[model samples]
Target: MTTSFETLYQNLQAAVDDELQTLLCHHQPRLLWESMAYSVLGGGKRLRPLLCLLACEAVSGKWQPALPAAQAVELIHAYSLIHDDLPALDNDDWRRGKPANHKEYGEDIAILAGDALQTLAFQLLSDPAIRRPDVQVRWVAELAGAAGPMGMCAGQVLDLHAADSVWKEAEILDVYRRKTGALIRAAVRMGALAGGAGPEQLQALTGYAEDLGLAFQIVDDLLDLTGSFEALGKTPGKDLMQDKKTYPALLGQAEARQKVESCLLRARDVLFSVPLLQTGHLLQIAEKLVHRET
Candidate 1:
């Protein structure tokens, strides 16, 4: 029997949502909690969490063991989004078809909520339910490295400055790798690591993720031009408005799309080169995301 990717995605998404609610709800200071929940529970494709779970299954034939890691990645993603949409950052209102968190709540509350969500991610990864002390340590290190200075943070800073500057392809790629690719690669790596993958298996999956990550970012840039606000569940053309550096901005639509295809081809080839990877869902996800409007 073939596993339905949409079904698995829905199921995993529900599980992650439930787990996040359980972990986040019922805390003190109802307003702060509400803001945090608002930021996370706002609808968006749970891509990072799904990648974490599916990568674990691909390596070990089980996704359940990586649930906590899935939640952690999603939380980290939510935190990033909350801050990304702030006044001093991307500076536009509306996320997921509604007001951004800072707009819905006050900026002060939104900032605190993002901070809390960031810490909550570590809390999820460090919980006793993870069942392995060393694994907990490793996940903590991986996620932190991915989200911290040299990874997503650095990318965002570089992107901020580059908004008003010109960047070559390599420089643009560096920002994309750090800003978007780092967490994505980390999500896959943490999942595979949780599944106890051998070094070769880890290396292969990492390669696939690297290529997939680039494709994902390029697609995001494409969607900004091609997707409707209703379809994207966020404002489109923000990139153009800010004059942000992106593949489409630098490479032209035809070349940027070609790059996306090239990246996807390499991603699949890396998966093919490795043996013993039950990564059908991962492959499906790459194809789906390449064509995704949201």
Candidate 2:
């Protein structure tokens, strides 16, 4: 019998957790490690890492080799959240239902923790353990491209600019594509590359990531509008409070959900064409992304 998606996800999450623990186990400076451990270990869906592992398994038929890449992407995500929550940015006081990293650890430690996780992600990727030197370098570039100026950071700048400003749909979507979609796109491509995917397969996976990423962000906007803090592990209504650009703000709740459904269909179509035995997990995830309460 085929394993269920939930079971597969639980197993993958466990592996990623183990890998993260091993990577940070022996680090020096108790405060830094403490902050790192607190932020990194803080619980969430692990969606990005799971995407990497699933894409790897879909192409290569195993998730083990992709663990390092999965861990790297997750660390980048954690670091981003840390920095995003600081007084300089979103100024959120809670995450995963606990005090935000900056609130609990102080701004200096929070900043250093984010920096450490970002650098450590590269350090982990550069290790010979995951892939060959050439392949490792390629993976690093992929991640950097997604997380750096042209990708997530660019989106963040646009978001900041959008505050107290009227935004066009194109502008909002551009932010979505760069900020959230970039890293997700990297996750899929990194997995495919690690699994020896050719150009055609890579292109297909990229298309899937694009749709999935947009849908994911749209749902996030919806959640911020409709979901409870307990469910989201962060403040709700912040988008409206800050006048942030978002799908629901521009498209309305009903239209935003419709857009997510359309994206989900596109994602499902691309993912199903890949001819992987493990495609169900992705399809199910797409469904969840559109339908999830949080």
Candidate 3:
């Protein structure tokens, strides 16, 4: 099953890469597209898009139909990362083992690239090939709500406050849900919806995504303190240097590790409740994401 999953993942990853490059054409303004391409084409796991396709397969057994939705989520993710690494934000210079977009391109170009990526995401969903206006509207709204001011943006605001205030566990978790989990939830929800999931099935998958998203963040928190620059593909100790309130900071290494384990188990149990024959991939993804070293 693992070997089969690996093969399937590689196939799907290749398809996403191809379509992503095809999405942005070589147009009159060369620099705009170039800056956007720099970060989107740069190396990363493509986890959100893969999760969307996998969720679709679990529901409909036809991931290909959900490919555009998968692409949309990835574009939104790429845009968020670009903005997150900007000087006014996280102020990081490295991403996916390369210079951040703002550094390689000028800050002005990087900002515009991020904007283009964000709007293009909606453009992809709005494609007539999707064949359903309602679904298109829902997808556009889903991605927007997840990435918009009330979602990831709201989380960013809370995170900035973490630097100055000592936070309770709940407070820190609130930030994680907004900063990391909202888009993850939207990815799974959009995929399942595209796959024609019923209410109960959608509920189950949503529960799974919420738990897995929290676990993913906790693991990232652990990695930031213990992982190396090479393994992480970016500076690892920024959280500490920035005095960012993270799970490890509040619970310590042992407790934080245990928290991740609990979340993963809950995610798995929630996934199991979903009546589907093809949930093996989502289950594996939850385990792999939480247990990943880099």
Question: Whole-model Cα lDDT per candidate?
Answer: 0.89, 0.88, 0.89
Model 1, 1-294: lDDT tens digits are: 136778888898899899988988757898999998997887878888888888898889998888888899999999999999998999868889889999999899999999999998998889897679988898999999999999999999999999667689999999999999999999998998888888888898899888888999999999999899888878899999888999899989999999999999998888777674586898898888887768
Stretch of 10 with least lDDT, candidate 1: 1-10
Stretches > 4 Å off in candidate 2: 1-3
Per-residue accuracy of model 2 over 1-294 as CA lDDT, tens digit each: 135777877888899998888877846788899899898898988989989988888788887777888999999999999999997888899999999999888999999999999999999899976548877888899999999999999999899889767888888999999999999999988888777787777888899999999999999999998889989999999888888989889879999989988988898788766566567777776676668887
Clashing pairs in 1: none
Give candidate 3 misplaced runs (Cα > 4 Å): none
By TM-score, how accurate is candidate 2? 0.96
TM-score of candidate 1 versus the correct structure, residues matched by position: 0.97
Q: Over the stretch 1-294, how does candidate 3's per-residue lDDT look in tens digits?
A: 398888988898999999998987667599999888898989788889988999889999988877899999998899999999997989999998899999999799999999999999998899997797877788888889999898999999889878787789999888889999999999998988888888999999899888888989989989999999899989889999989999999989999989998988888888778587588999887777888999
Reference-based TM-score of each model: 0.97, 0.96, 0.97
Error of 1 at 93 (Å): 0.6
Error of 3 at 195 (Å): 0.5
lDDT order, best first, reads: 1, 3, 2
